[model samples]
Target: MGFESVPSLPLEGLETVDAARRPVPASPGTTTTPGAADRAALRTDSARANGAATASPAPPDLKVVPLPVRRAEPGRDTPAAGRSSIIVLLQQVQEQHGYLPRPEVVRCAGEAGISVAQAYGVASFYNFFKLTPPGQHTIRICQGTACHVQGAQGLLERVQSELGIQPGETTPDGLFSLETVACLGACSMSPAVVIDGEVFGRVTSRQVPRILARYRRRK
Candidate 1:
């Protein structure tokens, strides 16, 4: 579903930042914590409960087993195949899957000869890699010092209201995502927003609707 823009309140006076002073985000890790453990716990508990309730013979106990390093098949090769580094393996995985699919990550562990837990740890440690699939469009709001002084905060709130989702969340239908960046290096475009890589400079809360509507129309 698309979002409807709320009427913007006026910012009396604010100064926009210059592009020259903007800094590169350089946020390589852009990492987030994974909920694999929680999922596993829930699965295990449900399985245990189900087993106890059944009158039939219970299944054998589950055991933790280390996965052996195996060559990835012809169509399943990790990027930089010959490398054994976990980081390299994950990079390859992210390159292919966009986000780290749990099954693909497990397969990666098998190919890299590392435990699944170890691979997940590595992926979760970095911020740049995403653990979940992203939406069709990505919207980045710059919240740098200059932009903030220019009322970037209100811009952010407007975005949140329009999207009906927080920075890390995707809409129910996965149409769009909202995220904040320290800077997009377009300080001159202070109070700027980037949607699908197109920068909108000198943006005001009032202009958000027109800019966002352009994308909504695409749907």
Candidate 2:
């Protein structure tokens, strides 16, 4: 649940360009071409025959709408309060946009009357606050002393080579993000790497390609 020797930097407020950008619109266009309309009608009939759609209209499933998140307001509040404030703000941003974008973080901070530092402090403290978008799968390698003593470095190199990315970075195809954590507390199984939080302990460099292949198969 905790780690030591992890190299962490303070979170910074979102950039200006992001803050100024407009939210992306959802929903498909209703306007259709003559050809598209014919194709859609045929597909609809096929789907209905396949039981994908029922003859009688079915009620839409209930959707749980999340509450709007608000950022912390910088006051004489304690750091703990500030952290909660930041979390709230981030939640609001995510709720509105469906993801936490850096610019939104800054905009939310400004809207909440909090300082960028306050937002960054909270963002960096929590591992969940991703500065960049995550991949379909995430791979975390242990850099703890015990793991390092074993073959963690070699394992990391294997991952980098296979994924073509260094730690704290994601693949160009957006299939994986490689992160280095100080320790996973699996000292007994040194040189561990976790894919999607599932630990693979005593991992050797030779296993890197195989491990990656397994993940690729999943994708």
Candidate 3:
């Protein structure tokens, strides 16, 4: 006998599962999808890793080094300090040679580390520093105010004529060297003439020949 089939169950009362909505098992080296905060954190971490791998090594510690200082040697002076010594050296050379000879002056300038012109300038400026050799006797005629008022010009002319030389020249016989001085400190005896260190004051034009004859007769 055929029996009537029971009615099919209602699909509305049963639950259904979708394959796409189900949780999946993760494979090796696979991760789940990250949220916004997690994605930001992962990017920061990746950037830091890359920067660390490509960065240069740190430099060594810096040190300050001082340079060496130089000290001057003993008894050695600078060029500026040595200028004053030049005068002293020149005086000594003049004392040794009696006059500043050209060769001696050059030698002195070399010793003093100065120029030849400088030494010559010093030599020529001072009246005491004679350039030419002096004769056996030196005659200094005074031309001070007292002597000038007392007819010293006449006495000078007489001396010049008798010696056959100027005021700054030596005689051909090498006996007398003539020079003119500003003062002889003998104002009381004006018109003074000094011959070989002897002061002859109140000298007239006639007395010049007699005074020079005394020195000429001397050995």
Candidate 4:
């Protein structure tokens, strides 16, 4: 039987048709090259995937700086410089009060920015600073080396007996206060006694009553 023959397709055309029908599998080591738009889309997807990791802001810089150290300078305004001023204030208080009164000393300490104990220490350390009030008249007996050798003890005893008071004591009448000093600067006249700023040289124990009588008469 004689039949009509159809045209046979080319091998390349068949390969093209097969490729359109089903995708060709890539070789093991081969990679597909991407176009510009495809590459850009891929980059956008990658950025979106890693957005959480790269979206945070950078941390701030922290630097530690040390403060400057201050040193005290010597001047009239400083604490050490105020020492002389405090002493002067104490002296003024003594001059007005005749002695270092406890209240006045406390006030002075406040003004000087010092402790009460410190103020009292200064008051007690010096021989001139008297803590008690003075009597109407003050009597000082010298007990220096020269005076002691010249029977100053006997004279002091006589005065105490006559006044009915011991050294650093005030008479019952408050007319006189007795005090013994290391020296009266009258060494040339040993056994010197000073009553109300009057210095009597080489005094004897017998002369005690007469010397005391003069002050009594004045009172």
TM-score of each: 0.56, 0.55, 0.59, 0.56
Off by over 4 Å in 2: 1-84, 91-99, 114-128
Report lDDT per candidate: 0.70, 0.72, 0.71, 0.73
Candidate 4's error at 19, in angstroms? 90
Stretches > 4 Å off in candidate 1:
1-84
Candidate 3 structure quality by residue, lDDT tens digits, 1-219: 112233442222122444334566678876654664365566667767888554332232344344342222224534433344455666887788777789988876666566778668767766667788888999998888899999998999999999999977788888888899888889899999888778898999988878888988893
In angstroms, how far off is 74's CA in candidate 1? 20
Report the CA-based lDDT of candidate 2 relative to the real structure.
0.72
Worst 10 residues of 2 by lDDT: 11-20
Cα error, residue 51 of model 2, in Å, equals 99
Residue range 1-219, candidate 1, lDDT tens digits: 122243342221233444324454568975433464355556667777788553333233343344555444433544333224556677887888778889988877776666688678767766556787888899988888878888898998988888898876778878887878878888887888889999888789888878778888888
Off by over 4 Å in 4: 1-86
Of models 1 and 3, which has the larger TM-score? 3
Cα lDDT of model 4 by residue, 152-219, tens digit: 99999999889898876788788999989888999999899999999999999999889998999999
Error of 2 at 55 (Å): 91
